[model samples]
Target: MRTIAIGDIHGGLKALVQVLNAIEVREDDTLIFVGDYVDGWSESAQVIQFLIELSQKTNCIFIKGNHDAWCERWLRTDTVDSTWYLHGGEETMASYKDVSLADKKAHLEFLENMPFYYLDDANRLFLHAGFTSMHGVEKEAFETTLYFDRTLWEVALTLDKRIKRASAFYPKRLKHYEEIYIGHTPTTNFDSDVPMNAANVWNIDTGAAFKGKLSGIDIHTKEVFQSDHLPNLYPNEKGRNKN
Candidate 1:
């Protein structure tokens, strides 16, 4: 009955599978994926298919990512922005070149239905990116910000919680959750493969889209599970090595 929050998969199905195997999910356990499930490696379609199947066997929450939004657009219109293609969309489309119509439809529906954010009884916020300010997921404005905002993480990284408590200039609702878990900003930016926490927010995207591993953490116990570096799993691919 553990609650696990997984970082971005970014089409690294092998890494995703390795982390899942390590988790040994139980019947009542819940899995929360922070999104970016596609647009990297060569198995974006396979990753979606696995997730579609996994949803039937276990409790799972899939949060839509910016990359996923690109996928949704392409899935529906069959055309997408060149920016997406440059940032791994080509590989993603290639992964599904031979996919069945039914599978693509299923994947499309899945992406379309994905919520921007998820909250639990423990008051933990799970999102793909960052958010401005919202009490409820329904009240979210500009859903893309949930997967694109960097300001929140920057504040979390620099803000002193004690000063925040004492400051009258800041809103009382500055942090409305016990913990916030996000995945858009990779922890690798901080030169770490493990999860990084600033204030009460946790950055778990350990750059699996690049030369890093896929990571998953037990939200309640703080137990972490990580897969091998994706470049090793995908020897022929360069992934997203920022120049």
Candidate 2:
């Protein structure tokens, strides 16, 4: 059975479907989504509903993302955060305009129950963003950092390729996992539209929220599956690029 690490979706349900179809998902394959399931494109609510149903037919692990946390709060309290509203939450709110209160409550529960990070039996770590603790995720002092931090990726990128894991200069955080898979920081930021690896960390977020494609990678083989660019799929939408 193959385990696939899917990148940040950001409400592109069409892109999500295309990527899954590209992967040709089997009954035994496990799909681990790194998160940001909502807030960006026009299908935020539909993406959540699709994921809820997908999990029932196959094994899936969903990690909570910062955008998702903001959406969840709005769903539960009927109040919007200005920052969130500016960053694609407005689109997310619009997507749920026709959703029933009971369906919203169920979606809220799904978001509320997601784990911040997941560790597989192979010691691979999957998280929406990054963690700050040198001792690993369990020792993280602030839960918010798990989905909001970028320092982890920054540090990984700066590490010298010559530095061996056994060397004194190796970051303790990177040493904690056999391999780490993360989303949140888009690979497009580095001028690439595909997944990028820094040190032992694999960043799968291909920036589907903006102009990039949704991506998924096989953890063991490192085979990548991508959907058509979001802009191509939704011609009239600006997505989060409007921000």
Candidate 3:
């Protein structure tokens, strides 16, 4: 079966629908969404609804993202953490004005139960962010597997002094298991439209929430489909604003 991976949808439901229609995914094929499914746009609730339906429509896997994690916390407690809101949770919360508590709870459970990482028989690992290899560290603990790998990052920050210690840190070590597909960190490096590296590790989060574009990669063919949203689509420029 053909496998396709879609990047962060954020809350751009229009872009999401366009990309899906463009792909023309078949029911027999498998589609894996690499998280950040909500936030950024005004249709967070609609996005969640679409995903729920899509899950039943075919063989699909919804991996959790850092944004997805905070969304759950916000829905459950009704208070958002600064770190979470800073990364698009605000837009998500603002989008859910009509959804019922029952629906929200169901969505929250779906978000919370999301797998941090997925490893195929061929060793292809699908994670929302990064991975950490340590004893007793559940795939969920890496957080980076669905958020960011702070521990590995903290070590990277100490490079000057760390280099003196004679030890090397290679986040690439996770590559040994199988290729990893990640999101969260946008491939675009601020203002640039170019996507980040996806060779050794497939990073599908093409910054759809930003001025860049939304992308989906066909795993088998390694082909990428993207949708751009630069010029305003709405006449008054209401929700047509870029993320």
Candidate 1 residue 124 C-alpha distance from true site, Å: 1.1
For model 2, the superposed segments whose C-alpha errors exceed 4 Å read none
TM-score winner among the candidates? 2
Best by lDDT: 2
Per-residue alpha-carbon lDDT of candidate 1 for residues 1-243, written as tens digits (9 for 90 to 100): 899999999899999999999998889999999999999899999999999999999999999999999999999999978999999998999999999999999999999999988989978889998877645444557777788888777878887667664466443334577888999988888899999998778999999999999999998889999999999999998777646
TM-score of each: 0.94, 0.99, 0.80
True-structure lDDT of candidate 1 = 0.88
Predicted candidate 3 versus true structure: per-residue lDDT over 137-225, tens digit per residue: 25345355547653433333333532322234544454355466777766664443443443346667777776657788887788887
What clash count goes with each model? 1, 0, 1
Residue 109 displacement (Å), model 2: 0.7
* Each model's lDDT: 0.88, 0.96, 0.70
Comparison by TM-score, 1 against 3, better one: 1
C-alpha-based local distance difference test score of model 3: 0.70
Model 2, residue 85: C-alpha shift (Å): 0.3
Off by over 4 Å in 3: 134-146, 150-172, 190-199, 230-243
Clashing pairs in 3: 130-144
| TM-score of candidate 2 against the unseen true structure | 0.99
